[model samples]
Target chain A: MHNDIASLINSSVPGANASVVNPPEDGAGDSSVLVDSSKIYEVCEFLKTNDKFPFPVLQVISGVDYVEYFEVCYMLASFNLENSYQLILKTQLKDRENPELQSVVPVWAAANYQERECYDMIGVRFKDHPDHRRILCPDDWEGFPLRKDYEVQKVYRGMEVNPEAKMNFEDREFEVRKKEMEADLLKRQLERGH
Target chain B: MQTWDMGIKELQDETQDESMNTELLTVNMGPQHPATHGVLRVEIKTDSEIVAQAIPHIGYLHRCMEKHCESIDYRGIIPFVDRMDYLAAMNQELVYSMAVEKMLGTEVPRRAQVIRMIVSELQRIASHLMAFGTYALDLGAFSPFLYAFDEREKILRFFEEISGARLLYNYFWIGGVWNDMTNAHVSYIKDFLDNFEGELEKYDTLVSSNKIFLERVNNVGVLSVEDCFNYGATGPVLRGSGYKWDLRKVEPYLLYDEVKFDVPVGTGERGSTIGDCYNRYIVRMKEMEESVKIIRQCLDMLEPGPVIGKVSKVIKLPKGEIFYRQECPRGELGIHIVSTGEKTPYRVKVKSPCFTHVSMLPFMAPGQMVADFVATIGSIDIVLGEVDR
Candidate 1:
């Protein structure tokens, strides 16, 4: 199956290969393979066309964010061969800034909602997706809530939804800023009057 | 935009219109409607009676069961798992147990395996009964629901005697079942199986054989085998499309490999590829009988032994990851467990049957009649709690 997948991916796209993962101890000998993001479509095409590793069903599409790079995983199940495999596609992204990837919904229609969910939570931009709006949250929702650095004490749409302890600190900051702004305004008004 | 009028008398004539095209009307079906079974809303666009498009709106019943499971202990989360897909509670519990067992490498006793097989098959029957009853009502036949409910009550009686509850019975534990059945429970099941055939005939006479029900379900939502595979459909939905793929036979969990029972598959299309609502209905109806056969065999082979394996008071699964899938009534229900060698699971991801089933609706529901849409959804047998979870 690994060789078949390798040949399939190699034949379909240039510079695409499958690397096997060491099987976990005391577990099913299920192997994982890594793929380049640039050749994802070629791999997808190969799986759909080839008989041995026909990725007929897309089980799940989730994003695993490493600090340096983002791993977009696609779990494909082959009914023809009665086996399943995972395709981990990695792409480096700027840290603290959202990165974009092409949508695989065209390859498998089932990936539409899953990708949207990935985008909503992980803040990955799925390029050219139809209706790439936040699915689990409102449209105007800020911050990728699932990100490790995402602050829990965040304000959105004029509502202070964070904890009361944080609210005290935020309130003190707000009062200090308000006083400074008011003093600045008074100074400006006095100058204008002069 | 322009207003047109010839005279006061001529304005009375409403037939003269320029917008000749008839547009598809959008109808929001339910966040509250009865047929939805729960808070599932499908935004449907229709041209008169035929559905132009359908976009299923889920998340209404989303309890975040996956995230919730991570916070609770492994043993503490079993009851909450039962509520996800409330119909096939035993199967839900079993899949979780299978995942935990796979992680721990626990071997359940042969006696317990047989008992698990028996209860799982019985739960399949009960799950199919709910599906069939609700499917009948969706197609405008109320009598079948009543008759099906009546038959289901007998199964519930058996369930109550075994586990103290009717629905949502958290019977299956990690290593084995919570309790072993008595002779009375075994005999009651035998009697129910004996009478199930006669009761199924009542359903055939009341609903399956009825012309109206047949017309509504026969070729309404034709999901091909290719579509079934593509959408990750399993259980009766896949089997109904002529795929002889049963996890019990393929994966052979518990004592299923030892059991001698036929895999009931649909003869799709022209006795081969129909894959329509009727095929799904017929497959489930036949599967109930098949389940009964397995149950009868289990009863004859029943042996007395300890029901549970060596399970710790605190189920601290070894630090590992295991994805266990089982053939549930609707489709494949899976539990992906990531254990950190702790009392609580590190992460729990449930691959719900209805999640895959409902994903196929946007494609299947279009080009179907508005009325047939409900029938098609019912045929899919979606429990929205599972979908939204």
Candidate 2:
């Protein structure tokens, strides 16, 4: 059903280059429609308004970094009205330096802050996003913290970011944790008949 | 000085006139104020007694839950997820376990599922009690807060008996529970429910119909059904808008399909309209009864079996992404994990209801009284820990 909706979206909506991305071999997740980053706003608008698949509620917009590019996911569901459906929309931006995507705030009001969060965590700026500022971090805070290559700065206004950075295995708490972990592993192995 | 019958633009055009003296007053309501709840600070722009805007500024309690999940192992992320919404940690753990169990394809034992249902319902009652306690105090009704705490303490005691910790219990494992629940625990839960039902009736008479509480919440901060959908509201907030959509009833995760429970939604009864603060509180109040019903059913369904499922030593998620959502006390707590066939997740994104619901403040706050803003904030039942996670 989700694939049929994706194909309908790909064919009906003009400039929509959406392709269904099937779940991997593990089958952990549902199949998602990967749309072009530039045409995401239209695809999302169509998804909400179209009669065939009207997924009105925009739930979460998450950003993931793949070292070379960023994948921005839009999770939506039709919990408000009839035709209950949970759909995922993905758009990948290969631009490492200035990753950008169209904002879906026009489609759903829930997109307002979630889009800000996406911009805050992974540095994926949403085009035409009103009040597009850092949400979880201060405006002056440097670096996208969620990115795999993100580096923590040595100092923020001379305050120590990591106060216990020099902690070694010789520390009392560390030694206690190591002992407790070993005990837990042994117990788990016994339970598994290892 | 208050005799301007013209609109805002006309008043601005006549700003040179001395009679129109009032300007928009912007007040910061807190990263510390009591009414704002936790570290949520709302910048309220008011014109006289009415609010023009209420911009919520969060992130004071941001703990980088996603960043930590990226580095931690699968089982290790459970306790970390518990802190996201500390009030209802069981539900959080349950949802996270469901996600991980999906990755590993682990089917939980029957007894474990029943125990999970019972404990999560108990946690819901406790969480809603805290919500009401704080919400009533926000509206200056202290007696109800005290009553709520007394009952909440009992639920906490039950939680302590099941798991060691009172607040954040790391009991629900990926495959199943940490330990099996004894039969004695079941009878104790039944007795607690018998007493709790009477206490709930006492509360309905004590505060639910109180004139002042109704005056503070009724018709104030009213959200239309369209506003709810557009704002992506869920849980009681969506239910308060007269929507009967519940994940338990509709989606039915973790043996909810077999259970018989009526999802109570806002009806806009004689005194209060739908989607108002009054209706929201009433929805939660009535939900406790429904929760009690679910727990009674779980007790009958409970059977003797192993608590934990068969899980391997080294757990790794395959290269894929999955989203698991469940009905939490606050709203839908979903965990969307993207993996790379590694020991740790590539990204763990949480869709907390507070984050979306709090955004509705700016939409609902305009044109309401400044005092009602407190009622509005409290009515949303936001936990900043989840909002800023």
Candidate 3:
């Protein structure tokens, strides 16, 4: 199914270099097709309008940071076809500092807020989005919070950035020891046949 | 009524005058208004009473759930996922657990699958009950709000007994459920189902068929089929637009395929077109009954077995990216996880239904009366926690 989608994308869309990737060995059941970042808009337009595979719904747009590069994934589903199939389209950005890709909002209206969220979190800019402001973060927030190197701000507008305290290592260790002691006591009591 | 009629004529005469210029009024609906549902603020441009354009401002409740997912372990993300859609926490947990389970190649036991389906459907009923109650409250029907919440309280009590939490339940785990269900819990749910059917009919008579509600909602905020697809509406919003696209029937995740239930779409039974606010309200009312049918079947299929699958305490997923979606009460809740074969995830993205539903306001709000805009928001059912997650 993925190979058919890749070849169809390559032949139908201009300037698109599409190739299918293998499905995960764990049987997750959907392989992805990598498309050239420059031609993603045209490729998405073709996939959405093409009679063979009219993927009417753009289910999600996810952004992933891989340190050296960034990848934007498009999860599309077709309700028009008899047997519905999900097409995963991935586009890679080699430039870490300025990662940009063509927006698919023209093809799918659902991509509007999802792309803005991707930009706000992972710093992947989508060109030609209608309203490209941050969807989830404040407009003044610095750095993409989801980036691997980004750090949480210490303060915002005079208020301390105090996350609810997580258990420290010593606390965790003490809790583990307490559980083990209780288990040992229970085992000993069972062995006594009382 | 006579004074309102005279005022309309007087205002019309004033607007008709060449020298009298009418200016568009900009009104800020919320970040705190009860009718806005949550912390949603819309800057509405109104020409007299009809809205010209509405621009929604979100992110007021932003919590950066994606960033937290990168730091937390694969199994530890369930509680955070539950917070996204606090009303339907079980459904939210089910989607995240399924995504991680798929990446790890873990096959959940048959009994656990049935339990997950039953719990998720019950959560849907509870969530929809809240939607119904709050929607009525927004429309100024006090009695239905009390009645709806009274019925919803029973479902919450059932959730409290089964999962030990009424609102935010971290009951579902990666491989399976956190705990097994008891016979008493099953009987409690069965009892609720039997009594709730009659209550639903009473609710229908109380609110669904109310003449005032029909007049207020019918033909108001009508969304065309084209607009629905173009704006990526799903669940009841898309179904209300007369499209039969349901993730349960179309995608059929988990044991949804085995369960026999009808997908209720709007047929314009009221005096308006199919995709009006009234149709959307009816679609939710009908869906509650279908959920009851699913829960009954799941209870019948429940068996005694190990709930949790055999997985190591320290969980790790293989390097890949997977996007899993489920038919949540609001719409389609999608979780996209990018793994790097590490304990912590590389990236996590949530496709919240409320976010997309809220985005469609600019398209639907124009030409609608200011009061009808509240009905539009109620029909779409936006939750700020999921929207700003």
Candidate 4:
């Protein structure tokens, strides 16, 4: 669906590199335009100022860890559906060790807390981000929770975040889980009037 | 007593001298303060009565919801979503369900759609009532709080009857609601809507249009339309900035396209700035009325039919990303779903309105009186659960 808008971004903005992230025939859900990580800031500026279709609002900014690469999604929308309603710009950062991307906060101030949150959850650093500190997590938090390989630390400041202490339950985790599954199946059957 | 009088006299003398500089004080207003509405803490820099800057500190209630959603299957996410904005949990569930339904490309049954619209609008009224009640409390009027919640309790009673929970109703599902509405649910809503206007007009005469309330909030903590959009403020915050934009009208998700309702906006009436605390509060007040109208229309259109579409228990969504936005009671609640053809979502990014609304406090809090700070926060009607989530 975004194939048209992705091609439009390529032709309109000078030196703008953009492509559809997941075209419908090949992928699931709606498609979004993936812009070059380095030039994402400039592309956002263009989208904000472009006369033909001004996406005045940066609706939200989110991050997705694809294991191999970290992808950031910038959701943009025009006020009142002026020309085009929405255009999602995504940037992929292949650097797994220390992922960094330019900040679009300069274009949309809405990107301020959202980008910080993306960093807090996904660990993707935004260059030129004002006060780029952790938004939702503590400053000393170790690993990004949203990452695929994320593991809970044994202790958070000496208090066990992953508690070793266990309650005296009638059953272990999988045992209780099995019972819950059976109950759910029976409930579904009853709801179906079987 | 003499020493205390000398201290007060010195303060009065300092006020008399225009040349005398007041000492700047740094005040931390609640990671626990009652007027803050929740556990939200704002670090305010003030000189005498005027605020110089405010930096809001959040994450006290962070449950790492997005992180948790990665492992949970599609259906289980609803209960978790309901907890995010507990005040407007139906709105939260509705938006999340809509996002998943969009990804699955499933059509919600017509009856299900009507009931969803009914609950969403009813939840809107309930949410605005809380906003009105608590905002009145923040502004130092205790009576309206009682009056507002009295009505809100009635809404909650029926909501409890239908959804089986009072505060966090996980009633809405992906393609349908959990339970079908009975005649009891319909009559409860109708009775509430019937008496709602008389109560609303009483509130209007009592607090919203009151001279004293206007004096406290009229021109205080104003945000222009440009500042509002730039910071991504939505719902009453955006509409109160004199923007007539509502997602139900513009985007028209669910049965919003079929419904007839007017989007209430702030017009700076009664000697107030376009986007002041007064405008924001009044917009929410007017929206409750519009919600009533929408609910009446939806109730008339209601008919007997199935409430759910044919969807499998464990839906394996295809590999793609979807960003869906809807107008919640607080503002625009957006769900960005990244599926990897699995039973569980790879990534579910929640774009909460309070998160953005709280971010802009620094923009609005400066240059206002120190007392008006709570007024500004209350006007936005932030539920810290959603803010931290």
Which of candidates 1 and 2 is the stronger one according to lDDT? Answer: 2
Best by DockQ: 2
Q: Write candidate 3's Cα lDDT for A62-129 as tens digits.
A: 88888888988888887552587887889999998888888888788888878988899889999999
Candidate 2 per-residue lDDT over residues B1-389, each given as its tens digit: 45233434444566667786677999999999999879999999888776777888899999898998987789999999899899999999999999889877899999899999999999999999998989999988888899999999988988898899999999999889998788788888989999999999998888888888888888888888789889889999999989898999888888999999999999987489899999898999999999999999999998888999999876887778888899999999888988878878888999999999999999988777788889999999999999998
lDDT per residue (tens digit) for residues A43-115 in model 2? 8888999987788789999898988889988898978444567888898999999988888888899999999
TM-score of chain B of 4: 0.95
- Native interface contacts kept by each candidate, as a fraction: 0.18, 0.68, 0.53, 0.73
Model 4, stretches more than 4 Å misplaced?
Answer: A1-4, A12-14, A24-27, A81-84, A166-172, A175-194, B1-21
Residues B1-389 of candidate 3: C-alpha lDDT, one tens digit per residue: 33222333355465687777567799999999999888999999877887778999998888888888887788779999989888889999999999888888899999999999998998899889989999999999988888888888998897888789989989998889988999999999999999999999999999888899888899888888778777777889989989887888887878889989999999999696899999998999999999999999999999999898888876888877787888999998888887777889878888888888998998888767788899999999888899888
| Candidate 3 Cα outliers beyond 4 Å, as residue runs | A23-29, A154-194, B1-18
TM-score of 3: 0.91
Candidate 4 local lDDT, B256-363, one digit each (tens): 888788988889899999999999999999999999999999999899999999898768887788888899999999999988888889999998999999989988
Per-candidate TM-scores read 0.83, 0.93, 0.91, 0.92
What's model 2's lDDT at B234?
Answer: 90
In what order do the candidates fall by lDDT, top score first? 2, 4, 3, 1
Relative to the unseen true structure, what is the C-alpha lDDT of residue A172 in candidate 3, on a scale of 0 to 100? 66
In the order shown, the chain A TM-scores of the predictions are 0.71, 0.83, 0.81, 0.82
- Cα-based lDDT at residue B255, candidate 3: 88
Cα error, residue B366 of model 1, in Å, equals 2.3
